[model samples]
Target: MPTLSMLYNTAIASAFVKILLFPCYRSTDFEVHRNWLAITHSLPLKEWYTSHISEWTLDYPPFFAWLEFTLSWIARLLGFDKAMLDPYNLNYVSTSTIVFQRSSVIVLELVLLYALCAYVRSMPARDQPNAILAAIDIFLSPALLIIDHIHFQYNGFLFGILMWSLVLAQKRETLLKSAALFAALLCFKHIYLYVAPAYFVFLLRTYCLSPSGYRIQFKNSIKLGATVIGIFLLAFGPWIYMGQMPQVFQRLFPFSRGLCHAYWAPNFWAMYAFADRVATFFLPRFGYSLPDAVNSALNGPTRGLVRDTVFTVLPNITPRLTFLITLFFQSLVLIKLFFRPTWRNFVGAVTLCGWLSYLFGWHVHEKAILIVIMPFGLLSLKDRRYLEAFRPLAVAGCISLFPLLFTPAEAPIKYLYTGLWVAILLKFNRAAPVPLKRQFLLTRVNLSYMAGFIPLLIYNGIVHRIVFGDRLEFLPLMLLSAYAAWGIFWSCISLIWLYFTDLD
Candidate 1:
C-alpha cells in the first residue's frame, strides 16, 4: 500500500486533473454575466447604465468594475456588440458570450492559483506536506475551478489576493505587500469585508505584538495604513475619474426587492424560512398573518403545484433585509474574534458565522459556498489546537460539495472536487504527526460532527414530508440542515474544548 503521504499527493494530482477538464456548466442565470459583458464592452462609457446587467453584477467591489472594463476591451475586440446583444435573452449557451466570459474568469483564477501555491510553498517544513498538499488540492479542485470560472462569478481573483496576503501576514514579512493585497481583495468584492476583523487580528499579532516583548512598535501601523490607502486609491481612481461613482454604487449594491431566489439552495436560510412557516402554521400568537406567496416562475419537468409553506411576519422582506440580518450575525462572529484574537478561535467563529449568514440570507446563490469553505484553510493552518475543530470543518466543506454534484447545476466535475475533499480529510486524519491522544481527539470530534448528519438527513429525506407534506422535494433542504447544524454544533464543542483543555 502506498504511504498515506503518497496517497495524499496522488489525490492532489487527481484534483488538478478534474479542474482542468471539467466543462463549464451553463445556467439560465449566466445571462446576467452576458448582459454585463454586453454593457461593459459595447456601450459608450456613459451609456453603460441603459445596458445595465443583473443587480448581482452591479454590487461587486470596485476593482471588479476595472476588471470588467478591461475584459470588455477584449470582448469588443472579439466582435462583441451591445447593439446585437439582448439583455432579456442573454443565456450563454445561445452565443459566444459565455466562452469569452468563462475565459476571462479562468484567467482571473490563475492569479488566485499562483497566490495559493505561493502560500502553500511557504508552509513550515515540519508540517505534513502530504496533508497541506491534500488540502490545497481540494481548493484547486474542479468544484472551485468550475464554479468560479464558469457558472457563478469571478471571486477567485479577490480570494487569491486575500489568501496570499494572509500567508504573508502569517510569515511576518512584507506587511506593506500584505496590506496592499488585502485592499485589493476588498476592492474586488465587498462581501469579504465581513472577515476583515480576522485580518485585523492577524496584523495585530504578527506585527504589533512584537517578539521584543514590552515596547509597542508604531511604525508597522503607519506602513499598514499607508499601504491600504495607496491601494484603495489606485484601485478606485479610474472609476472616480470616469465620474461613474453613482453608477458604480448602483451596480455594487443593487439589493433585490425579494425574499429568496426562485430556487432555494440547501442552506440555512431555507431551513429558517421553513421553520418560519411551521411556526406561523402552528402558533400565530402574535397576530402574524402570512404574507403573499412569491411565485418561482416554474416551467420544467419538476414544475408543478409546488407550495412553499414558509411564512413571513414582515410582508416585504427583501434580499437586502436578509442581508442586514446576516450582517448582524456576522457581527457577533467578529465580536468573538475581537475578544479572543487567537487564530484558531477567530477563524473558526468567522467560518461558522459567515456560513450561517450566507445559508439563511435571501437571494442566495450556490456561489456563496465559498464563504463557508474558504475559512477552512485558515483553520487548517492555525494552531494544532484547531485540528479537532477543523476535522468537522473539513467534513462540512466536503458535504457542501455534494449539492453541486449530481444536481442540475452545470460543472459536473464538482464530483471530483468533492472526492478530493474526502481524500484530504481522510489523509490528514491518518497521517498527522501528533501523538495518539491528539489524533484520537481529532478523529472523535470529526466523527461526532459527521454523525450528526444522520439525523439531519433523516429529517430532510423523510421527516420533512411528515412536517411539510413533501418528502423527496426537501432533500436539498436536508443537506443544508446538516451543514448548518454541524457548523453551529461543532463550534460549541470546539469552544468548550478550548476552554477546558490546554490547547496551547
Candidate 2:
C-alpha cells in the first residue's frame, strides 16, 4: 500500500513534469481556450454563445464558459494583457498568455489528483496496492500527457470531476451525490453525454428501483430526477431565460461536423474507412468502378477535413445511424448492468458505454479516447483479464494521438514518455499474480501486435520523413489510425467477452 506521503510525492513529480512541458508543442486547442477566455471576458452574458468574432465560438456549455470567465480574472492577475480579451484577438500567443493557460491546466489537474487520492483511500486494504498502481497508470497516462500537457486541453480537470463521480457512485449510500456530480460534469463538458446512458441506467435500476424485486421506488426516483433536473436548470437557466435555447443546442450538438473526425479516431469507423480503401484498390482488378461522388468522399478523409465523410465501397454513415449503433451496443451493456447492478458491473457498463460511443459516435475526436481509457483503467485493477485488454488498448490508443503532436520537438517526447509508462505497467502486470491460466496463443498474438507499434512508430517518425517526405503526408496517419483501430477493436471485444463470461 502506498502511504499518503507517497501519493503526494507522485502528484508533485507529475506536476513537475507537466511544468517542464510548458514550452512543448501545443495544438490549436491552446488558441481555442484563449478565444473562449477572450469571449467570456469581453462579451456580455447574452453574447456568450452568440458571439462569432472568432471561429472557435463558445461551444461548450455555459458552466464551462463561466469557468473560463472565472479563470480569466486569475489570468489577468498573472500579467495577461486585458487587450487580449478582445473578441477579435485571434491567435494571441504572448508569453504571459502561454504561461497563464498552461499553468491553469497544471493547477486544475490538482482536482484530478485529489479525486485519484480519494478513490485510492476508498478501496479496501488488500486492494490498495492495485489502487495505487491504477493511480500511477492514470497519472502517467500518455493520452493525458499528449492531450492536456502538450497538445493542450482541460481534459485532466474534466476527467477529475468524472473520477469523483464514479467514486461516489460506487456505493449505494452516495448514489444521490453521484448523480449530482455527474449532472455537474455533463454541464461542464457535454462530451461526457456519450457515457450518460450508463449513469442513467445504473441509477435507475439500483437506486430508483428495487434491486431484488425490480419494483419502482417512486420517492427515490423522484429525488434522483429532481436532482438531475435542478442541476440542468442551474446550468442552462440563464440561456433559457434569454431564449437562446436553440443556439445553445446547436452549439452543443453540431451534427453538421459529419461522421468521422479529420484524423479518424481509432474505432469502427477507421476500420470502415480502411476497408473502403481496400475495396477501392481491388475493385479495378475486379472490373468495377466507383461513382465519382463516392470516390470524392474517399479523398475527403485522406485530406483530413472536418466535413461529411463519403464512402466509395460502403454506405455513407448518417448521424442517425451512428447514434442508433452507439445506443444499441450501449443498451446491450446497460441491460446487463440493469440485472446485476454490482459496482464492478456498473463500472464495466460505464467503460463499455464510453468505448461504444467512441467507436461509433459521429464527429468523434481522437482525444475522446481518454473517455474509454480512464474508466477502463479503474476496471483493469480488479481483473487480470481487463489488465490484459487494457495493456494493448492503452498503448495503441495513446500512440494514435501521436499525429496530433507531429513536430520534431514533440515526437521523441511522446515516444520516450509513453515507452517508459508502458514498461512500468508491463512490469507491474508481470509481477502481479494471475488466478486464471494464461492463454499462450492470445498472449503471443497481443504481444506481437503491440510490438508492431515499434516499427509503425519508426516508419512514421523516421522513415516517412527520410523517404517519401511530404508527398505521402497522409500515409503515416492512415497507417497509424488503421493499426491502432485493430488493437482497440480487439480490446473492445476482449472486454465485452470478459463482461459476459467472467464471474465476480
Candidate 3:
C-alpha cells in the first residue's frame, strides 16, 4: 500500500527536476500567459476578452483567465509587473520572469500530486501499488515535462483538475461529484470539450436515469442539470450579461485556424495528409488531370498554418466533416457505456472519447495525447487485455509528442527521459495473466514496434539533418507523424473492440 508521503515524494522529485529546467527554452506560450496576466490584472473586466494589446490575446475559457488573474497577484508580489505581466513587455526574459512563470507551473502541479495520493488511497489495497506506478508515470511523463516545464503551458495544472475528476469516476457513490468536477474542468479549458460526449453519456445513463430502466431519476437529473448550468453560469455569466458572449465564443472556438495544428498531431488526419502529399506527387505522373488549385497545393500542407488545410489530390477537410467523423466514433463507445453503465466501462468510454477525439478532432495539438494517456492509466491494470491495449498508446503517443520539442537542445531530453520512463513504468504495471500464445504474440508485436523506434529516432534526429540540411525540412515531421499514427489508431480500435465485446 502507498502512503500519501511516498506519492508526494514522487511529486516533489518531479517538481525539483522541473525547476532545473527553468533556464531552458521557453515557447511563445510563456509570453501568452504573461500577456493574459496583464490583461486580467490591468484591464477592466469587460475588456478581458477584447484586449488586443498583444497578439496572444486571451483565447482560453474564463476559468483559465481567472486562474491567470489569481496568479497575477503572486506575480505582482514578486515585483514582475512591469517586466513580466505588462502586455507591452513583449518577450521579456528577466530572472524574475523565469522565477515567477516556471515556479507557478511547479507549484500548480501540486494539484496533480494531491490527485495522485487521493486516487491511490481510493483504490483497494492490492491496486494501490499499481496506482502509485501510474501516478509516477504521469508525473514523469516525457510529454508533460517537455510541454509544461520546457515548452511552457499550464497543461499540468489543467490536467491536475482533470485527474481529480477522474478519481471521482471510480466509485458508485461519487458519480455526481465526478460530473460536477468534469463540468468545472471544461470551464477551465475548452479543450476538454472533445471528451464532453463521454461524460454526457456516462452521467445521463449511469447517474441521471434509473440504473435498472430508462426512467429518469428526477433528483439526480435535476442535480446534474443544476451543476452544468451553474458552472457555465459562473464561467460565462459576466460576458453574457455584458453582451460579449459572442465575442468570447468566437475567441474560445476559433475554427478558422486550420484542420491540423502547425505541428501536425499524429492522428487519422496526419495519415490523411500524408496520403494526400504522396498522391500529389505520384498522381500527376499517371496521366491524371489536375485542377489548378491542386497543382499549386503540392507544398500547402507542409508549408505551415495556412487558412485551409488544402490537399492536392484529395478532398479538402472542413471543420464540420471532422466534427461528424469525431462524433460517429465517439458514439460507438458511448453507446456501449450507455448499455453497460459500469465504472470500468465508464472509464474506458472516457479514454476512447479522449483518444478518438485526439485521433480525429479538428485542430488538435500534439500535447492533447496526454488526455488519452492520463485517463487510460486508470484502466491499464484492469486486465491483461487492458495492459496490452495500453502499451501501444503509451509508446506511440509519447513519440508523437517528440516533434513538439524538436529543438536540438531538448531532443536528448525527450528521447532519453521517455525511454527510461517506458522502461520503468511498463515493467512495473503488471496485469492479470493471459494465454501463453496470446502473450507471446503481444510481446513480439510490442518488441517489433519498439525496436522500429531506434532507427526512426536516430535517422530523424541525426541522419536527416546530415542528409537534407534545411532542404525538405518538413519530411522528418511528416514521417514521424505518420509512423506514430498507426500505433495510435491500433490502440483506439483495440480498446473499442474490448469495450464492445468484453465490457464486464
Candidate that would win on TM-score = 2
TM-score of each: 0.71, 0.96, 0.95
Report how far off residue 129 is in candidate 3 (Å): 1.7
Model 3 bad stretches (over 4 Å): 1-5, 291-295, 429-441
Report RMSD for candidate 2: 1.7
TM-score of 2: 0.96
Which residue runs of candidate 1 sit more than 4 Å off their true CA positions?
A: 1-24, 47-50, 53-57, 75-89, 92-99, 128-131, 140-146, 204-219, 238-247, 255-271, 280-366, 381-388, 395-420, 435-504
Tens digits of per-residue lDDT for model 2, 1-504 = 456667778888988888888889878899999999988888889999998888888889888999999999887877677766776878888777788889899899988888888888889888887888888788779999999999999999999999998898888999999999999999999999988999998899889999788899999999998999999999999999999999999999898886779988988999898887777778878889666745564466766878878787788889899989999888899888888888888888888999999999888898999999999888776756678888878989999998899788987798899999888877776535575756422766888999999999888878998998778687788889999999998999999988877665
Per-residue CA lDDT of candidate 3, range 144-235, in tens?
88888888898777888888887887776888788888899888899888788888888888787887899989998898899889999999
The clash count for each model shown is 7, 0, 0
lDDT of each: 0.55, 0.86, 0.81
Name every residue pair that clashes in candidate 2.
none
Lowest-scoring 10 consecutive residues by lDDT in candidate 3?
432-441
